[model samples]
Target chain A: MQINSSMKKSFLFKSLVDYLYILNVGGFLLLLTTISFGFVEINVIKGGDEHWSLLAISISCISVLTCIVFLRGVYYLRKMARHLLTHKYFSKQIIKCLKISGTHFLLAGVMFVVIMILGWIGKLREGLFEFVYDINLMVPLFLMIIGLFFMIQSEALLVAKNFKEENELTV
Target chain B: MPIIINLDVMLAKRKIRSKELSERIGITTSNLSILKSGKAKAIRFSTLEAICKALECQPKDILEYRDS
Candidate 1:
């Protein structure tokens, strides 16, 4: 069959999703390899104090969990993109994927906040108050907002699906 | 739903097949089936008028309301 304009657009969007998936996986692998090879040192506290070491380990664990959550979210997003590519716009799979991905992002955001708080407390104990001025803290805030946006988008899509069903069923 | 479609009964009473009625009313058989099976959320006035004309019956003949 001949392709239409909408199909072309969907194909373009699918390609974009493919790029995002590749970039996410590649960046994650690169980060892991760099960290494991001692190329990028993640030293949170110097002198190796017991309490600071515990805080560092906890922060590292939370960061890894956040990364895993982000990866899972991207996986579900890939699934949703595949469904859209096949023109299954209102499929239940899309809604389910959206919900799963949204939850993952929200969880990642919460984990990030926990990591920041732990790091903040650690720094306060070390008498370093300059950590609060770090501009990198906006990342978790943006993640939370994006997560809520995805959740709301899924709800809006659900409403649109209901309307489509009602229109189709009307005889 | 409390509002039920009785298109099947009307079709049977008129001795018309679902396919024939759908063709006559310019609608698909699946849509006609939805109406017959009471799965339709709502019916348009134009479609109801077309169905009424095709079956030669009043609107009440094909639609009935009942308390849940």
Candidate 2:
């Protein structure tokens, strides 16, 4: 059958969604490798007759959990893109995915802040605060802002979806 | 929702089958079914005109308003 304009649009979206899925998978693999290597380094430090502190274990656990949440957000983004490709742009599934991803981003921002505060305290205890610039703290703040933006975008999508539904039903 | 479509009643009174009426009105059988089943959110004036002409009826004969 001959392809129409809408089918062509869906095809383009499908390609973009595939690219995003590849990038998400690559990033997730890199993150896992980094976490594994970091754990090895921590183990080496503990092997030098020093016990692993409770704080250190807690930080590692929190880091892994936060990463998982962030990855889940990426997964939702991929799902949303796939839904768009399938011409389900104004669906409940898309809205739910957006909201879930937004919430994950917000949670990741909070986790980043907590981790940064812990790092800052550790630096202060070692008299390293003098060398730490305010610029170093900007990342978490930026993430928080981005998270808020995602949340707002999700809300906007929800409203647009509602309007589209109403329009469709009006016919 | 209170504006009920009496399309099926009119069709019955006119002794017309849905498929024949839909064909005469240049609409699909499914669209006619939607109108008959009261599932259509809104009907176009052109479609209403076509339906009225095909059924040889007035607008009020095919539509009724009742308080919910």
Candidate 3:
């Protein structure tokens, strides 16, 4: 009983679910504001003699979509943390949340890569290939790696859940 | 699947109620019910011994094997 109480208290004290939920909401509001500002700025710039290129518009669209997907991954992660706080470590809902979060991360990474490739091609067309470096490509690669890691972790959790069920049913 | 619990039969034969048997064996009625229903995946030797002792029966009398 003492151990159970301590465990409950520890989860309550250590869980970042609430904080992440707040951050997700705040980040979403910030993203919305930023996108709105970008649209206004784009219109203002278009009113002048300089018009936005198709590549620039495509890049903005991809960037916004990637940010949305990343935010969704954060939301799912928050859900997983909430489940952990409830002592549901091996639940199906938690596993599904993890899987969804990982998929979102992967999708965000793919979108980021597409944006980067478009940017690179745009630069190459302007004869600026020498400025393109591997350092600029690291962030999307990292996101992909992190996404794969989470997917593998979710599979491990599924196996652990199966074992826990078997143990419980063994009386 | 072949292993079966005959706890209910022994309890009936000995005229021992499940609640009384559970109290004497220091186990919950739900757990005893699980045993009786043959839904328990495994039983500890201590629990089996306690059950046998409370029911006044041998292990063989409380358990049976049937070719399923």
Candidate 4:
């Protein structure tokens, strides 16, 4: 009974899931505001230039899409965390959630990289490309690594599930 | 799958209910049911001993081999 309670309230996963939820909402709102600002700049202000408006709109559109994909990943992570909280360490739902989360994260990472590349190319064409390195490059790279890790963890958990079943059946 | 547990038979012979036997052997009713239903992968010697003592029977009386 004590174990069940502790498992049900595992603070680490609970906190992590909560943090992810905040991040998801914040990211979505930020992207929406950016898109709104882009439109306002283009339509409301006659003095505003076209290039920044267009760039902002395009970037925000792409970001909104990526955020949606990333939201899916976060959703699965929350589901997975719920299962973990219930002490269901080796179940089909967890494996499926992990797999889905991994795919979404991988897709989001790839899309983000593409967006950055396109932006970089646009700047280069405009002769505005900077030579300095951008730390923002690490975000997508880390996301991809996390996706791969989740995939690998799911596979590892698959094998562990078999062992767990075998152990459970042992009288 | 080939190894069968005949704990139900022994329980019947001993006129003991599953809940009673589980209590006597200090195991959960679900685990006892698993043993009786032949779903258990393996039985520990200690559990076998406890069951044997509770039912006043040998391990052979509680376990059997089947071709299927």
Give the number of the best model, judged by TM-score: 1
Q: For each candidate, how many residue pairs have backbone atoms clashing (under 3 Å)?
A: 0, 0, 0, 0
Per-residue C-alpha lDDT of model 1 across residues A1-171, encoded as one tens digit per residue: 445877888788778878887998899899999999989966666545434477788888888888889888878877887887778878889988988888888888888889888877877888887556565688888888888888888988899999999988877
Model 2 achieves a DockQ score of 0.40
Residue B68 in model 2: shift from native, Å? 5.2
Give DockQ per model, in order: 0.86, 0.40, 0.42, 0.64
Residue lDDT tens for model 4, A48-150: 4545556556766787788889998998988888787767778989998998899899999998998887677656766785654687888899889999889
After the best TM-score superposition of candidate 1, give how far the Cα of residue B21 lies from its true spot, in angstroms: 2.6
Worst 10 residues of 4 chain B by lDDT: B33-42
Q: Lowest summed-lDDT stretch of 10 residues in model 3 chain A?
A: A40-49
User: Which of candidates 2 and 4 reaches a greater TM-score?
Assistant: 2
Q: Clashes in model 3: which pairs?
A: none
Candidate 3 residue lDDT tens string, A1-171 = 966996787576446656766777787687689877875344421224376778777888787788889888878887777676767778998899888988988888889999888877877767777555677588888878878888988999999998877666553
State the lDDT of candidate 2 residue by residue for B1-68, as single tens digits. 89998988888899999999888988888878877888778788998899889888899998899999
Best by DockQ: 1
DockQ of 4: 0.64
Model 3 segments more than 4 A misplaced: A1-31, A34-54, A130-136, B1-6, B23-26, B45-68
If ranked by DockQ, best first, what sequence of candidates would result? 1, 4, 3, 2
- lDDT by candidate, in order shown: 0.84, 0.75, 0.80, 0.83
Which portions of model 2 show Cα errors greater than 4 Å?
A1-39, A43-49, A52-54, A125-142, B56-60, B65-68
